[model samples]
Structures are given as structure tokens and as C-alpha cells.
Target: MTAVIAEEDINRIRWHCRRGMLELDMVLARFLEEHADRLTAPQWQEFERLVSLEDHALWQRITATSVTDSTVERLLRGCIIC
Candidate 1:
């Protein structure tokens, strides 16, 4: 069974979703609104990793403008923004 994400964790992730780029911010926000509550622990970890990336790197992954790590790539593919 998937573990429930903690409220504190969700809030933290929500804050991290705010990006320097407006386009990136919009995409991440939409993904969070639609999927944050349902993310499994592993997915949360992957998402945290994704958010930790520099803005350009994260945007590249979202836009498929450059190659990304497979795990993050997979997660991006599942997001509504992708």
C-alpha cells in the first residue's frame, strides 16, 4: 500500500514547486494540484529530486529540450504538465 503524504511535506513540496520561470511554475502547480495527494513515497522522493534541480535544468526536463535522468524523465511523463 502507498503511504499517505504528510501535510507538512505537502506544504514543503508546494513551496518548492514555485519556480523562477512562470511557465515552469504553472506546470508544476498544476501537477501538484492534480497529483500531490496521491503520490506514493517513492514518487515523492523523485519529485523532490526534480524540484531540487536548477531552474533551467528542471525546465529542460519539463519541456524535453534536453535529456534528463530516466527516473525524473519518467515522472515528468506522468505529470499533467507533460
Candidate 2:
């Protein structure tokens, strides 16, 4: 909660990341909580790009089951253990 993200910004991102799927919500929210504070501007841009994806596509990239792009996959590699 103490990340550089202002309250409004966090809320906006939270809203965007809030998916109907519980698993998606948890993983994305947790990533924001744990890593948001340390993210550089470029990382934030990448994250915004990732979150903008549809739930299924984002899940695919995060899980590596059907990676469409190596760049996004690489960005999330460290955050996702699977």
C-alpha cells in the first residue's frame, strides 16, 4: 500500500486488474502489492500493457501455456513460479 503509486492510481490499476476470476485477481493484485514499489517507469509501462490484456490472454502469458510474445513472457517470468 506504500508504493509510489498514489491512492487514486492504485485504485485505478486495481480496478483494471480486478477480474471475474479469483485466481487472476489474486495473482495480479499480489504482484502489484509486492512489486509495485520497486517498479521502474519502463516496468510500469510494461505492466500496464500486460494488465490491458484480456483475462484469458494475460493468464496464458503468465502461465506460459500459450505464450504469444516472448517479451511479455519474459517480463512476468520472475513473478510467476510456474
Off by over 4 Å in 2: 1-4, 65-82
> TM-score for model 2?
0.73
Q: Provide C-alpha RMSD values for all models, in order.
A: 2.9, 4.2
lDDT tens readout by residue for model 1, 1-82: 4559888888998899888888778878877776676677877788899899999988777667455566545556556343
Cα deviation of 71, candidate 1, in Å: 7.1
Q: In candidate 1, which residue pairs get closer than 3 Å at backbone N, Cα or C atoms, i.e. clash?
A: none
lDDT score at residue 2, model 2, on the 0-100 scale: 29
Candidate 1 C-alpha error for residue 6, in Å: 0.9
lDDT of 2 by residue, 27-63 (tens): 8877877777777666677788888999898887787
Per-candidate total of colliding backbone pairs: 0, 0
